[model samples]
Target: MVHHTMATSTTRASKASSKINPMNLRLLRFLSTALIVGTLVACSTTPLPPASPPPASSTPPAVGAVPGDTAPLPPPLAQAKSRWVPVRWAELPGFSTDALHEAWNAWVKGCERPAPAFAPLCGEVRRLSIASPEEQRAWMVSRMQPYRIESLDGNAEGLLTGYYEPLMDAARVPGNGFNVPLYRTPAGLGERKPWYTRQQIDTLPEAQAALQGRAIAWLRDPVDALVLHIQGSGRLRVTEPDGSQRLVRVAFAGTNDHPYQSVGRWLLDQGLVRDATWPGIKAWIAANPQRVNELLWSNPRYVFFREEPLDGLDAAFGPRGAQGVALTPGRSIAVDRQSIPYGTPVWLASAGPTAQLGRLVMAQDTGSAIVGAVRADYFTGWGPEAGDVAGRLKQGLRLWALWPRQP
Candidate 1:
């Protein structure tokens, strides 16, 4: 999602625009605060699996070491560039200490549309509902085996980045201060593999004609809109034509088919900014307002979105991910579908520049950039605080997929 200053509007056009009223500004602050604290933490129950046999020996395993348990191991599933090596649950860092109850929500969501291998386990998973963290941990130990994921070249370490659902102010119709358009997918999008480039979408008559009357919302900043495109989904504080305001979500519908090109990389290549973060990009844009469009057009990829209602419980959850489950704020991850199947429970351990994270996360989503066996995009949830964490979260990472033990 796009990142920008949450302060009052300072642009001359925005100041002159009637849309930037006190009510709107108040709503923006309220939304920002809501986004930060909207993440719900609740306790629920699921069914537990039948008990398994005790370990071969009564002795506890060494810390960070996998014990030689006599549990049966399943044959490894082949992937394009990764292999899974079976390991005991004791090998997972912080596995016993993590708040598994927190992650249970995401796991239960995954069960709604489970992977083929995981389908049979879903009923038991639900039975474990309302289980304590320790109970959940013990149940997992009895029912699942942790598989260390390694790349083809034998590397267990890989990169981890973060992403979130951004929140922005928008208008249902073009007027007042909102002028930039966020479009739905154009007709005949399937006709072209790589659709019109960003520059062409803004300049070509045919492209413009195709998108006419398709604007889902209008924003004050085109750069913010670009961020929404990159993030693939966002929450909009939309002012309707009837002057009513409501919170709604615009999820990824389709892309232009062109490969994603990072505008931050463009800035780095141009040597205009050493730090290509969202703040840095915004600073660059502030200083070079005349060339903001040039910076945006540098990337060819364009994304489209579909509007979703944000009412009742829907407001508390995020868009459904690749696993077809509504993503849990701190427990959902996007991985290489080839390396780790959607709906799998994963143990993530990372220590790097941004933060240290060791937790149980579900592989519920995927991204274009999230390639390779060890690569993943950690979903940080919605709001600016989440965005801040996501923007700075490139780190050294290791992962273990926890799958059911074979009989």
Candidate 2:
């Protein structure tokens, strides 16, 4: 699954000159978080302590509680549950205006491993590459149906976020300020149920013993390393023990199987930082270095990685997504597998603190947080600029899945 991390900054207009260069590759990490409107709003605003859990009450208990119990069940969502509704292409907000040719690149990638339903249409999809936008639109119109996704109670809007690969400096040996080690998945991981939590991995001797001789690379900043863990992948500019430098990707290998707890949510609950974006989180860490371990242990989930060479064509494309295709920057989205099947084409529209976006995106990935029918996690690609955009993009979204018509 393609997981995405949430961003809190407002989106800025992208420069027209910005383009992806295969030779100049950047590392990206795909991390997914299950964020709701409350979390999104909390991340972007001043940090406030979560409402106190109800104080002990002397009164009798309400439904779902024992006679003396005061803890309450969480309230139901304010928005309706998720569902899908059929709609016409004409109803799509920016259907005709999008540059389908650009999206066609993503479609072609998906065709490499098309779903069973779409397998037969791959040839026609390829042949139409040379066709005009109007022709492509016509072909889609003729063969596909657009379904407007909604919540069970018919709420059409949902949250939109983004994630990207992060690039950082590293070393082969643990010295010269590169102290934190990124580990490969340990042997016999299969035998363990929900391996060590981040705290145990960091502090326990047995947990540390399993990782001995398994350091993939050593990093300077523990927070940077944690960011890599959260994203599930990252590019490291490694200074080898022999004094040579090379770029390599640390792709997701395995995890500790612990449930992911949002550190942002932890900070919000603690009333520490006002903004929980990476920048804000980093700021809090810098000012309170002593509390670093305390903060790191807040999230129990731990991710392991395997080194992958970033050379040739691999440098140009992203890590293979859940669809088994190299993700097209800005064109790939991670959705809930249950809501939108992999390889489906979708029209995405959103406007919020982040920039406005309306275009064609392929459902080449899935995320833990992308649960509802209308939810999506847009891929922002790699490098610092992509990270900037990824960290800030939280918006209201609408989606229409374009599915092949039944024969």
* Candidate whose lDDT is highest: 1
**Model 1 agreement with the true structure over 277-360: per-residue lDDT tens digits:** 777778989999999989989878888888988865566566788777888777888888889999999998776545556688
Ten-residue stretch with the least lDDT total in model 1: 7-16
lDDT of each: 0.73, 0.70
Query: Candidate 2: where is the Cα deviation over 4 Å?
Result: 1-82
CA RMSD, predictions in order: 11.2, 13.9
Give the distance in Å from residue 301's predicted Cα in candidate 2 to where it truly belongs.
0.6
Q: How well is each residue in 101-154 modelled by candidate 2, as lDDT tens digits? A: 667768888999999889999999877765676777778877876677777767
